[model samples]
Target chain A: MIKTKKIHKEIETLITGAGTILISSHVDPDGDSLGSQLALRRYLVSLGKKVWIVNHGSIPSKYMFLPDIDRIVRIDNFKSEDRFDLAIILECPDPGRTGDVKHLIGANMPMINIDHHPDNSGYGKIAHLDSGASAVAEMLTEYFLEVGYKIDDPAATQLYTAIITDTGRFRFSSTTRKTMEVAGRLIELGADPRYISDNIYYSFSESTMRLIGKVFSKFELFDNGKICLMALDNDMMRLNDFNSADTEGMAEYTLFGRGVIVGGLLKEMGEGSTKISLRSRNSINVGEVAHRYGGGGHNNAAGFQIDLPLKAAQEKILKDLREIVNGTV
Target chain B: MIKTKKIHKEIETLITGAGTILISSHVDPDGDSLGSQLALRRYLVSLGKKVWIVNHGSIPSKYMFLPDIDRIVRIDNFKSEDRFDLAIILECPDPGRTGDVKHLIGANMPMINIDHHPDNSGYGKIAHLDSGASAVAEMLTEYFLEVGYKIDDPAATQLYTAIITDTGRFRFSSTTRKTMEVAGRLIELGADPRYISDNIYYSFSESTMRLIGKVFSKFELFDNGKICLMALDNDMMRLNDFNSADTEGMAEYTLFGRGVIVGGLLKEMGEGSTKISLRSRNSINVGEVAHRYGGGGHNNAAGFQIDLPLKAAQEKILKDLREIVNGTV
Candidate 1:
């Protein structure tokens, strides 16, 4: 018996009692972060509360179509005189995950932390964290429904995007019966699944497509196809006019090959440095490998930056991956 | 005003009264058709009824991991003396859609037609057609739940696959609130979304990945990027050791480029023949264009064959696609 109902009531009371609210989420905001921020902002605005969404990073081009996306402002633009009675941070394990937005909040101001990360730091005054929830938007949607808050069409679409993307279109193990039920309710409230999907997935730029083609064509399999490696050097990025943002979700493509237990994407970040993103299946913990290289993430997906050239980084990572495949690591 | 409950009762009575049953779906079975057939067969088997699933085509390699996929035998294996008292055809608009399996059914045998296609011919003694439904699996899940029939783990998994694939992982316009709710119920009944999605999506062969790379690398955009085209010749297929089945779902990749309203895939068959698969968005009905070439499909997707070389076929289709982009045809 989790006290989820009591937590929801407390969060609701915090929202209603506040006059001015500031909302923020983790940096490098993906679909889940941006969607949850916008959905929560929309709902709070509907309650006639003065609300502002400030984030450390700019919105990605792919997520620009989200409703009220423009409402999110950069942390650099925060005014010193602006005071918030309450702060609602979503999808962040701790205040540091919100990046520079934490500096704008007064030290004594109450913070409402809503997150679904298993490692949430529980730093806020009223923290409502559920690792079982698929996404922060899932937690928010549940709270809204439990407290009888009307989720309008825009808010519903935003939450729907958050759930689908975070749960990998509801195919992730984190997705629950409650996730699907909330998504269904969002649909009833006017979230057009086709419209949102087309905007998020079908709007890839030509450069991104070409980059993907090049990357896929050059992918190499190792350890009898148990380990798959894909690289994006600086030259490939410059040639295709690609940027770091375009490589956001390409890590998943490495695991598409059959019999691939561990997949890695080696990205050359100029100089002698390389960034490696790893994905694994069959209970192989890539996060442990990432930790060995001073990186941290979930068991299935993780990344790290190395002070080595692309070739050197590949060799090092492949050695470890091979050991892991052989069950010797 | 709808009599769905009454229809469910009639279908229930029909199921309970049947001694021996045969389950089948449209030829060239996809996830929805195969899943619906398997789910229905499993449910009937639980009822102590002898149920056999006979299909016209073999299951695709990607769907071989489905629970009890081996239970679905090809039509060639049906014995002459194997007569069934009740024939339940799923996802088929008409008997012809079932191919040779329809020939084995006795003329006087009672047939139950279950489909979600708008063009259903209503060619059964008891037809339950609802175009609004996302998939036949959705309809069956609803029926089973309503009649208090237990959906075992295998049946639930099959139904979940059918719903996800038919709805494009819940991103298609056909998906509705009811679809999500039913999917939630299936999840509660032991459907593992991650396992099903992994088997259905992430099990691509090496040749398939190489083929996709080549296709994506050579894709072309016309008419200010609104029309995108990709081609696969025999030489390319042979070089990659690929077959026709490898091209499954490749048509969707054509529409992935930003601003692409019309997308087409041209495959060079032997003897100077070509087959074209077309996809469109923003209400640009590709079916109408396919009809001009004597092919047929739904509004957003369609296909046809032309008696010309790859280059000539590309030229001819490009001309029509240009006109379609200009709204002239």
Candidate 2:
């Protein structure tokens, strides 16, 4: 509570006299990053602050249903002449996470770095890096409530999406009572939970379901049913006309099997490479495993790309995973 | 709020002098029914009252992890000499919904019908049926708070499962701020959301995932992609070593498609009959449609069995569904 109050004070001090504001989230922005950015922008704009949302990456077609999503300018569309009194970096752990947009933040301009990553390296004039928060939007919602800002339906919808997606529909371990309380309040404020969930979860193309079927069939159980591994080979990818987004959350399927500790999905990235996504149900740290392979993420979910054939990649990755599980047990 | 208070007072008055209690939920109880029943039974026992939980059907194997599940006696195993000062029929629409246990309610035994079914027939002497509630557990949680009952970790776990399962992890339309607030309190009381969710959703056998793979293959879109119908024939059932529980909630798979308004699953019941389960997204009235086919259920979910071949049943049901969709559109 004291820390929350301190962050609120810091946010107030930073935004009090600011005029025009520039905002951007991490590259390959998810619902949490994009939704938080848009929601924060709306709140600031309502305070008569001129806000320019220049995201480093484009929004997914699936999330285009969010209100005013079209208003966010992509990095390639950002104008050099766009001036701002302040910049707000959202859901980005470090400057590099912002990709090309780091060039837009001038030395003299003050920046407020807001993030929920546990390992966030605070890199702004003011930082509200709360690792306890389920999503960056959750922190912003708290800030908004404390600062007496009214969250309209549009802002509520975006923030709600951020929380919902980040919390994996409130199933992730990070979902606290506060998370559900915020979600409930958001729903009461006209953010339809059913509508948002349908758009995010159910509106997949038939081809995506077909791909899901194919991926599901290839699932293999190992390590006394503690690990489940599935691969989308080059042939299947070609057959499905696979896009990067198609395989999103596919690895999490492994954790669905009873007693499965780790679930891994290795997607053929072509050119003798495979992108490995891992999801865990318990204390098994897939993030550390991913870090060893030049990748990092949350304890429960992580990913890395291996420059090896699918079979070879699976073998090496499974060996490392087995060792990790064995050590932990 | 007033209604909630009234029900609270009535419950206090009813349970004040009551000693031994008999409790039972509806037949084929899902997580909501079983969880709610178990939580209530725990609370009652904590008050130094003797409690016997007799359900029409046995508890599902997946829910065996719930504390004291072994205490619940199946209706078939219920002894005739058992007597109770009060009876609590949970999650049952009417007396008939209790299946074979209807005979257990003697003329002098006062009953409390706790339910959330929209079409619940108020039959109990003291009906605490709040259709607005997401589940009976949600209502019971409020009652426990109102009456000053200490919710233990085991009880919290049970109640939490009840809410999560009923609300579809807070995605359903009935979920409110109050629901989330209650959920938050339950978690704070030691209801591990991750543990409960994994058990309820992800602890399915490998055969279940294989069945899901098969279901995905059988999806057929019709009514201009607004309706999706999937089926498991007698052959498929036999091949998979079918159980009555295997096809449970399988019809809900249709609601996952992009434009699907109604999703139906047809299961071959053998002996020239097919059972149909219907799930709807948004405002499609599946219950009313099921009523036309001599079945009854909620507005969004309903089921009925047809005395016809699988192909004939599918054709007939599809035609009826197409007309309903056309009329609605």
Candidate 3:
């Protein structure tokens, strides 16, 4: 239901006609972006169409389990000699969102943009933007189904991972009956739910566990427990040798605390820079709050970077969050 | 499709004929046990049956969000004069698993035992043991559908919680297409997935967070990272004022570490007493390990209580776990 007949037909025609295709997603790719890109690349290669997956940044260690992950060429490693008749920019709102890959999209090359973000800036010859869809993988699943393409186990597993990550394991509000139905189909196609969950969520490094311990140890409540904030200092990060990937899901910790309407994680990214992640419950829009800080995301989960001391950043954010809570109340 | 004609018909007859029904489940009732009980009680009450929902142990604070949870009387508070025409025990493998409630099951009153455990003893007059089902809640869902019972929001939510907890939010091997189909139907019936996930998994008390910090701080990996063990001493528990509920998912922490084939959690219960929870990956059967120690559970997860001191208990358990790993490899 997510796919329009014309767009679906257009995609099928492009894939069939193109001798080679280039695929990519946004910078600092998450599971959905990587999984969707890998899935499409695999399907195209299976059909005997030459495919090259190029991305702006290195894939996270956690997502290395995806089949053919090594096939994804980093922008730094890409050569101009690579030939591709068509390019599929996945999950990105705009061409620039693909980072350096935007330069690869020549004026003559046909481009198809597949995305599910609500604020997608349509920027391709064929823009298949299903904002109602849970993930871009859902859009890809619909397209594959529409073309009657036989999805293999590898493709199904990657797509399933994309759906799982994007929908937060089907706990997000975007998850509908359609989402569950698609997941069911994926599982039937040989996507092991338990295997994917264990690999993605349970494979925590010792250092990562220590970092999590530090986060929980520093947890604090504010505004009569309406707001929660936890900080991971530069020293802790340096001691544990953890990166952004290691701190994934740390912001949601605040949401777990009783009476915490807003959960916030502040990471000291060094040299007066702090990365702040916010997760809100109910009508409180953390995205709007993030927008004020020159960042954007969904209503419930959002983030922004501040060029201020960690303490100052926390104070400033708390002042704004308290207002949001007070106004909403 | 999960419904069997004979079992459905029998359950329908029992419910219709019984004016007053007593419902109970195993001691230390989990979400699946409690949720299934609450759901069935709600459905029967809607049909104008007087339901006296009784349980041997107190319900966890985390599960108090269920509709009319206050209605479930604890055995400590139950009066002997209370009369019931029928007793429905849920999720328990046998009558004795219901703890002290086994004594309350009169010889004359008819009993219906609904369970999904493979080890079910079939103690009831009419035992509806669907071992293929994911949870007792799944059985209840099938029965409700078979008899054309209208599942209200409360009942649907409870059942949804039951399925989610039993199947580890559909990440366990027990999750099937039918399980997802049933869950989708429950969501359609007004079961809020996000609300339930947040409340059950995320809602941790401040003390609970401290307890988690304590657990992580003491995390240890032995046998070249094949075995993981963490401990929460009585000193830490007393200092943080944490109860049994505070340590709900602590055992799972061990399974998250990289290269961990076996995960163990040791809790100092009292003087010269320690409780051990074991979780294993793949072929490593923690249940067999627990059985050796006079405890019993499923293949991957199991537990036992030791009369020995914490250090001595850990040494013995770790030695056995190392042997299991050595033998399997």
Candidate 4:
């Protein structure tokens, strides 16, 4: 608690001291990054400070419903003449994750690194990184509470979106008692959970829905149903007009089968290369498996690329996965 | 709040005064009904009370992981000689909803009707009905808190499951600040949210996954993409070895498309009959549509049956749905 208070004080000092603020997060901004950026921007703007939210990538269509979403400017659209008194880098492990936004930040510029990732490199002059937080938005909510700032409805909704998406709607292990409490408070502050969830989860393109169907239909189980794999080849993608970005979260579907311990999604990335994403349910560390295959991730979720055709990649990876499942079971 | 306190006192008195208790919920038990029963039974059992959880239907395979779920007896296995000092009917609007369990309760026996449904008929001797609550488990959590009872881990898990499933993981409009607060407290009491969600959502049978894929693949859009329909005929079911129960939540998939205002699922029920489930996103009342076809439900979700083949039913329902969409949009 004391540590949180100390960090909140440091962040408050930075915010109060700044006249013009710049906010950005990692490339391919997710709900957490976008939400955290918008939420903090809303607060800073409310304080009569000039706030600019510049990001490397355009916001995903699903998250376009977030309040003040139009205010987020892409790196291509950001004017080079723009400057800031302070920069707040959110949910980024390192400044490099901010892409071209880093180039805009001059050396010696005061930066506040706000993140929940444990490996955050502590790149800023002041940092408030809580590894235990479900999302950077959770940390921001704590900071707002500590500084006695009343979070308005729009900011509450944005923060709530960040928390829900990052924690997988509170089903992820990172979801703590504090996360739920923060979400509850957000709801009280006028964050409509149903509205936000409807927009984020229910709005799917027709092609995307068809792609999901095709992908799910091809799901294969091996090693006595302990290892499940869902492979999407170029043919399936072309037929459905699927974008690679739509493959997000599809890897988790592999673990939906009853006995599945290790699940994987193999995407044919063209040029005889296959990108594989793996998720594990139990003690089997998929990260080690990914590492052995020149990829890295957390124990439960990991990924690696194989320089083989989809069919050959499946055949080769299944042997190793089978051996692992056999050894574990 | 005062009403809640008064009912809490009444419930406490009834609970303390009873030595042997009987618990049951509506037929075709859901997570809310099952979770509420188990949580209540756990608390009562901890108090040294002899509790019998006799339900009209068997527990679903997905909920088998709930702690002490084996203790719940199907109405067929309920002992004829068993008696109860008090009967607690949960989530049931009327005595008839309990099926044969209603026959087991003596006419003079004290009963508690605990429910969150607005139309609960006030069947029992002492009823505690709060329509505002997300689930019966939410009401029970309030009761436990009001009575100063320490919710154990197992009960906390049960209650947490009840809240999540009923509130659609806190995404449903029924979810409130109190619901999330109670869920937070449950986590603090040792309920593992990830474990519960995994067991409830991610543990899909291979056959069910295939069925879902097939269903999604077959989804049809009409009326300028405002109406979506997914039909499952006998061939699809037989091919996938699909159970009718697996159709649960499949109707929601119809509304997943971006422009979809109304969605319907048509299932072949044999004997030249088809069952149609409908879900709506906006002001179009699906219940009214269902009522036109001799069925009933709420505004957003409803269902009805037709003495027609799946194809015929689809054509017939699509016309009406098209008119409804055209009229509204």
lDDT of 2 by residue, A107-166 (tens): 898999999898889898998888888899889988999998899999999999999888
Pick by TM-score: 1 or 2, better one: 2
CAPRI docking class of candidate 1: medium
Query: How well is each residue in B1-329 modelled by candidate 3, as lDDT tens digits?
Result: 33478888988898899998899998778889888988998889889998887788777788888887888888889986868899999999888878888878899989999999889998888999887788899889988987888898999999999999888778877788788888888888989888888888878888788677767766889988899999888898788876765576678889887788899999988789999999887888889989887776777888888898889989999999999999997
> In model 1, which regions exceed 4 Å deviation?
A292-294, B291-294
Best by the TM-score measure: 2
C-alpha RMSD values across all candidates? 2.2, 1.8, 2.0, 2.7
Alpha carbon lDDT of residue A164, candidate 4? 89
Q: Candidate 1: deviation at residue B160, Å?
A: 1.0
Steric collisions counted per model: 0, 0, 0, 0
Model 2 agreement with the true structure over B247-278: per-residue lDDT tens digits? 57566677778888888999998868998999
Per-residue alpha-carbon lDDT of candidate 1 for residues A48-146, written as tens digits (9 for 90 to 100): 998999988777787888889988888888774668999999988889878899887789999999988888899888999889999999988888888
Task: Give the Cα lDDT of each candidate.
Answer: 0.87, 0.85, 0.85, 0.86
Q: What share of the true interface contacts does each candidate keep?
A: 0.78, 0.73, 0.63, 0.78
Candidate 2, residue A200: CA error in Å?
1.3
Question: How many steric clashes does model 4 contain?
Answer: 0
